[model samples]
Target: MGAGHGHRLHYHGHSRLHRAPAHLKLVALVGFMLVVVATPRELYPVFGGYALLLVAVIASTGVPFGYIGKRMVVEVPFVLFAVLMPFVATGPRTEVLGLSLSEPGLLAAWGLLAKATIGVAASLTLAATTEPLDLLRGLQRLRVPDLIVQIMAFMVRYLDVVTAEMGRMLTGMRSRGCDPRSPRHWPLLARSVGALFIRSYERGERVHLAMLSRGYDGTFRL
Candidate 1:
């Protein structure tokens, strides 16, 4: 009913950050995430510092706040699960706000939330600012096996095609009064899943045949 989301990454004005080599940027991003993920959960100050650091980087990129906020929605499930820990976790039970809260558990929950938020923010920033081609080039430079890089490149390239095909198949079923949401549709759901598998297999075979006709080999030469 409205404009769809953009999967392709875009570049913006020439900035110092944009001028940096992809490999170096990727390494720094990875390291930052690891630090946030590994830090002790009870260390709120450390987490706050990490969050501020990420905010600084995000500000440096000049990306819109709305974009980062929208992407952070991806962390909701993790945050919810972390929220549940305080109630179920075994530890010194303390009453807070007229509810039983595990002291250690509260710390654990906050830790997970902080880490997840920081991690998502970092990933979103990297993804929003860098082009996929540059990301692949970075991977290649980092000694990621050539074959793996090629597979990733192809997957990213064809992901839209595959998703569209699957969506069409789902739509056809829906049009025929097949309600996937209903519990009684389990059998139909299973069949549809099986059909999807067959379709994917056939698609792969046809693609292989086409590649063979073009004198292709197992190795994907860049």
Candidate 2:
């Protein structure tokens, strides 16, 4: 639609990775992730191989390390969950550094962390090289259902709009002396979230009606 509308994650580049067809990149990502997921956790050396492969891809793409690192913060929550697995999992115990831990949990945690990190890194690399609209086009070309593709497209297109709306709502709250960090303002913050959801839902309904009026026919013209 717009020049920069669907290029938020795309880095301007003339590298071979950037020039590769979007559908091919999508297939490569899926195949690589599938292999990573299928590998056994106990195969530590294999995991190392996956890491090295991703490193080579990153090096080839010419995406800055700092940009990838910053985007990777989104995976921190999953990492934290994996970190707790060793402490909470019940299984055979092992001693390490003077502390007893579940052996299976340790292996599981390592697998989770390794697979997750590699997957996110690969995804980030793909997004950096391909525009958002190109991703949708790739999915369509790959025979994904039209309805699912359109849903994903709309979600990506309006994410910025929803985020900006939430920002403005928070600004309004702040101007009225509401401090979200204070416990007393927790309810206000919760209400704001609910209000934002309702507004977004109503907006979606309006957009749907407008689309129907224009003969959208439940499919995007690519």
Candidate 3:
């Protein structure tokens, strides 16, 4: 991947975590997440310990807590699902704050929220410290298949490109008096989205042909 590819997520730090070998960091992250996942849900205090451990790691990185908090908006869907569980799930009900909610679901939601939050925080921390290219190299070192790594590399590289394309298309739509945000314009928005997909697909094909012409044989250097 290019130097610019994953720089947005990286905080450009000089801490030990920043200098740690990418493969080692990857292994440590997976191990930490596994331990968090395997812990019994009823052992709520253990999750507090896990959260503190992550907090220590985050503090060492010198990345702002608010920065991590802002990036955590991606986990809102998980939060919403967890919030609904107590009401929607089937179980014996209990009262809290003058509301009846499923007892089992309350526990399940707590467990789900804790795990999901920690997982997102850990992954974001990793991204904040490590470059995309280093992560790919780490994957290769771990014997992850070259083809899979290459696909990941390309996906990272193209995310910005695809996003820019979508932005331009949206701009064009607004220029033509089709407001994508308006309910009546949804059909136009959907068609534009379809067009964007076709354009992206064609761009991928052209990229593949270019790579092939340059002696790529189903794989190239990462």
Candidate 4:
């Protein structure tokens, strides 16, 4: 990846966490997430401990809480699924707020929410402290497969390019009087998505050919 390709998730910092070796941080992050996942759902206190640990990590990074909070919106779909679990799951029912909810489902939902939240927060914290290139380097150092590392490297490098292309496509559609909110515009919107995919695929192919010309031999060099 080029030095110019800085990810939005990376917060510029010189703190200890930021300076920590990328592979070590990667190992720590995976271990922390694993511990969170392995803890029994009934062990609520353990979950609290995990939360506190994450808070400490976040505090050390000096990244803004607002930045993390905004990114947490990515977990909203999981939150919604957790919320519906109690209502839809079949099991022993109990009354809460004048509605019957499955007892097992409620516990399951709580566990799911807690685990997912912590996992995402940990990931966000890692991203905030580590640059995209450094992350790829870390994975490479950790003996991750070269092909997978190359894929991730390209993803990090071209994500912005692809996103900008999509934005331009959308703008062009709007300029052509396309109103995506209107039912009549659904077909056009779908076609736009298809076109975007095709364009992205072609662009990837071109990039691959260019890489090959430059002696990129199926492996990314840090």
Error of 4 at 122 (Å): 0.4
Worst 10-residue lDDT window, candidate 3: 1-10
Per-model root-mean-square deviation over C-alphas: 3.5, 2.4, 2.5, 2.7
Candidates in order, TM-scores: namely 0.82, 0.90, 0.91, 0.90
**Shift of residue 1 alpha carbon in model 1, Å:** 16
Model 4 C-alpha lDDT per residue in residues 1-222, reported as the tens digit of each score: 233446889899999999999999999999988888999999999899999988988988899988898999999999999999999999899999999999999999999999999999999999999998999999999999888987897888778888888778888878987757788888987898899899989998998899899999876565
Stretches off by above 4 angstroms in model 3 are 1-6, 177-190
Off by over 4 Å in 2: 1-6, 181-187, 217-222
Score candidate 1 by TM-score against the native: 0.82
Across 4-41, the per-residue lDDT of candidate 1 in tens digits comes to 44454443635566667889889999998877778888
Give the best candidate by TM-score. Answer: 3
Per-candidate clashes come to 0, 0, 0, 0
Put the candidates in lDDT order, highest first. 3, 4, 2, 1
Could you give candidate 2's per-residue lDDT for residues 48-84 as a string of tens digits? 9989988888888888988888999989999999989
Q: How many clashing residue pairs, candidate 1?
A: 0
Error of 2 at 6 (Å): 5.4
1 or 3: which has the higher TM-score? 3
Q: What's the distance in Å from true for residue 7, model 4?
A: 1.3
